[model samples]
Target: MKRGIFIVLEGPDRSGKSTQAALLKTWFEALGREVIVTREPGGTYLSEKIRKILLDPKSRIEPMTELFLYETSRIKHTLEKILPALKAGKVIISDRFTLSTTAYQGYGRGLPIKTVETLNRIATLGLKPHLTLVMDIPDKVFARRERAGEKLQGADRIEREPDSFRRRVNRAYKTLARRPGITRVNAGRPVAEIQREIRARVAKILKRQAWKRGNKKQ
Candidate 1:
């Protein structure tokens, strides 16, 4: 059987990664594909438990400790959920993934980029996403959203971080967007417009995958 595509929606907080992920899943299903919508740091049972600790506002976790916890959650999520889904030819639309770690911990927290990359490779066993949609929003738009109280309800530890940290993370995402296999989407636009751009990109990926499979059989 042909291996399935892995698409990740990665961005800073409240950038509509979750919303786009859901829309992507629906679009894939409409194409008669098996779609699995999941999130990082909380895919499997144990991972979900770890997620609570990682996101709890009261948890005072050191930078290295936080990094390890995320990687731990990722390894479990990969082995128990992601790999199997892909093996079964199911498209996996994840809310966040390794790029998130690189952005948040490496850039946002001022951790060593090389160290973060090493841990990421170890955790995911070098598994890479076929497509990563990096949702990009301007600082002014982010501020507007905050003022509108969009994600203020029971904010997580990361969400509640100070302005400086958020600025670092926002910049981190823009930097990461330069990497190959990642598409940066202007998330400040209307939701439908953003989804249309995402769908166009996803269609190209799916088409390419189908072409490759056909070539392999010939």
Candidate 2:
């Protein structure tokens, strides 16, 4: 059987990654495809445990330490969950993946890009998303969202970073968006508008994948 499609939604905190992941899951379900929706750094049991430490505001995790924690979580999440689902031919809609590390650690934390990329490769075992949707939002919007009440109760360690850190992460995202296999979606617009755009782009990729599979079946 053909492996499943992997779609990763990436963005900084409060950037609508969760909302989009949900919408994408719904869209894939409506199409009658088997789908497994998961999130990075917390997909598996051990990964969730790692996530707690990584996100706890009181935790004083060094940048390198944070990087290793993320990698370990990815290794577990990918091996136990993501890989098996793909092997079963189930579509995977993930909230974040290795790209997150690249943007957050490499760019946001100012770690060496080469080192970050190397670690990501090790964690993922060279697996990559077929398509990545980057939700791009401005700092002004982020500031407003951060100020809004009720987002903090569940806020984690990463969200507690300063505005300067957020800007750096956003910059990393912008740079990565220009690379291959990545699409940038303006998230400052209406949520519906953003979802519509995402659906349209994803549709194209699905169609292309379908064509490839059809050829293989011939």
Candidate 3:
């Protein structure tokens, strides 16, 4: 069977990654493709348990412990969900991936980058997304999200972090965007506009992959 592409939408809190992922899923379904939409730290039953702990503001988790929990959840998610779907040739749209760990734990929580990368490798077993869309929003838009009560009533533990921590996380995402397989999208614009750009980028990848498969078959 032909392998499917893995695409990830990653960004800081209130950056609309989940919304964009949902839009992508719908768009891909309209094109008659087999697609699977999953989110990290919560893909499997056990992983969701870890997710609840991670997102509980009342819980005090040490930086390394938090990082370990994330990796553990990812291990279960990858083994139980991601790898199987990919093997079945389903286009996987992940809300976040290993990059989130590096950004949130390594950069946001001041953990060692090398150590985090090592753990991530172990958890993912070297699997990686074919493309990653990193959303970038302006401070004004973030403030608006807060003012609209999106941040006030719906924030997870990480979402409730201070401005300094969010700033660091944002910086890490920006830096990650410079790396290969990562595309930065300015999400401060209207949702439709951003979605259009995302579709365009993904279309190119699908086209290229189609071409490659044709050549192989020929």
Winning candidate number (TM-score): 1
Residue pairs in candidate 2 whose N, alpha carbon or C atoms collide under 3 angstroms: 55-157
lDDT of each: 0.90, 0.87, 0.89
- Could you tell me how far off, in angstroms, the CA of residue 16 lies in candidate 2 after the best superposition? 0.9
Pairs that clash in candidate 1 = none
TM-scores of the candidates in the order shown? 0.94, 0.93, 0.93
Residue 76 lDDT (model 3): 97
Residue 60 displacement (Å), model 3: 1.5
Q: Per-residue lDDT tens digits of candidate 2, residues 71-147?
A: 99999999999888988989998989999999999999989999999999998899998888888988778767652
Q: Kindly list the per-residue Cα lDDT of model 3 for residues 1-218, writing each as its tens digit.
A: 55688899998777888788889999998988889889988899999999999999888999999999999999999999899988888889988999999999999999999999999999999998888899988755766664222345667798788999988998898898788878999989888999999999999988998899999999
Candidate 1 lDDT, tens digit per residue, 154-217? 7789988898999999999998988877899999999999999999998898789889989999
- Model 3 misplacement above 4 A: 146-154
Supply candidate 2's per-residue lDDT for 190.
Answer: 85
The best candidate in terms of lDDT? 1
lDDT, model 1, position 123? 98
